[model samples]
Target: MRAAIIHGPQDVRVEDVPDPAMLRPSDAVVRVEASCVCGSDLWRYRGIRPVAHPVRMGHEFVGVVEEVGAEVTRVSPGDFVIAPFAFSCGECVHCRNGVQTSCVRGGGWAGTDADGLPVDGGQGERVRVPLADGTLVAVPGAPGDALLPGLLALSDVMGTGHHAAVRGGVREGSVVAVVGDGAVGLCAILAARRLGAARVVAFSSHAPRQELARRFGADDVIAARGDEGVAALGELLGAEGADVVIEAVGTQGAMEQAVAAARPGGNVGYVGVPNGITALPVKQMFNRNVSLLGGVAPVRAYIDELLPEVLAGTLDPGPVFDLTLPLADVARAYEAMDRREAIKVMLRG
Candidate 1:
């Protein structure tokens, strides 16, 4: 099997690796049909996030089951499925309560019994999915080739966007402000519309992302940054702030802007992987009664609900895929994203 091996920063190469086999009664091996280079993948690619070993480097993927363990009953060898970025044990307390991302039995990236078997990432010809029953969702039928991108979005980005809206308590007629224009952020904009947000404000400086954001349902696109951006948001909202602010940038600056752009008693739903130390003004939050609630998006919890929309073509997130490359050219995908030449990169395995 040829997999993308991350030897170090900017050193992802396609190399032959041992094919994954079913190691447990709950395991399943998937022949990856489509995968993507997520924004988080760039953290390591740019050396911001460390990769100590040449581990598998992607998570968002859709594939067909090649083999399944005896215990895997929900899906069979030929079923096409979308694998969530995180694997969970459905029986765990967190998972039972619909918080699969924090399932007590699942651990991400760091491999261990907690994470079950080391599942190969999607940026490869094949991948081993742990806790197959709990992690992979079988699509209704063999979807069209065009639906692949949208289906693949459900694996993580789209689901994460839905999570962000859920966390922010977005409802019809509510004003939502999204801080960031990354893939997840754009998806967040789409989710906000799906959730009935009357007005969606996206802060983006890039022309391509701004267009996508508006197409996704952003009523207003604010092209400013820092305090000026916050003021612009205030101006757009009639001197008030948005009812809900979704933070998808995952940086301290983006977080601050999100906080500043929300009205009193609003919610800040964040999904960006925080880069180390983050500073939040607790005093302001207390005085303004702002509720800060978010963590790693519980993508698995919302996959079922969001999947149908993609299948129906009511929600098209495929626009985020500005660049699609073969598995062998994943390094160039990373470079395009890292240099901001592309909004998001989709890789076909």
Candidate 2:
């Protein structure tokens, strides 16, 4: 099998790796069909996030199940499925509470499996998926070629975007503002519309990103940043801030802008992986009665509901992929994303 391995910053390669097998009765082996490069993957590619050892990369995928462990009764060998980025035991306390992102027994692509075995990640030709019953969602039929990208989006980006809206407590006819125009943030714009937001505001300076945000349902586009940007948002909302704010960027500037753009007692749903050491003005937040609540997105919890929308053609989140490349040219794809030349790169195996 061939996999995408990152040897160091800006160095991604497609090389042969040992084939995966079902090591436990709860496991399954999936033949990769479609996988995309996520914004999080760029954190390591740009050297902002360290990679001490060469390891597999990529966490969003839709594939075909080639083999399954003895205990995997829900799916069979020939099933097509979408594998969530996180692996969780369906029976955990956190999972039962609709917060599978913090499940006690499961971990993301970076953790151990239900059987106490390490899980093989996405970004490969074939990989072993542990906790099959919990992580893999079977599609009723093979999706058409055109629906591939949308189906793939359900695995991570789209789901994460929806999580932001849910966490932000978006209500029908509410005014919502989104900070950050990355893939997830753009999807949040779409999710806000789906959630029935009356007005959606997006803050972005890039032309390409801002255009996409408008297409997704943003009623107003603010091109400024910093204090000017905050004032622009307030003006757009008739001198009042938004009812809910979504912070998809983890930087101090982004966080501050999100808080400043929300009305008193409003919420900020943030899912960007924080770089650690973020400064927050607790005094301002306390005075404004603002609430901040969000972290790693519980993407797995939203897949079932979002998948049907994708299948129904009501939502098309596939435009997030501005570039596509074969697995062999993955290094160039990584560079394209790192340099901001591509919004999101789709890698086909």
Q: How does each model score on TM-score?
A: 0.97, 0.97
Relative to the true structure, candidate 1 reaches a TM of 0.97
lDDT by residue (190-292, candidate 1, tens digit) is 9999999999999999999999999999999999987899999988888567999999978888888888888999999999888864578778888988888
- Give the lDDT of residue 302 in candidate 1: 86
Clashing residue pairs, backbone N/CA/C < 3 A, model 2? none
For model 2, the stretches where C-alpha displacement exceeds 4 angstroms are 114-116
State residue 116's C-alpha deviation in candidate 1, in Å: 6.5
Worst 10 residues of 1 by lDDT: 108-117
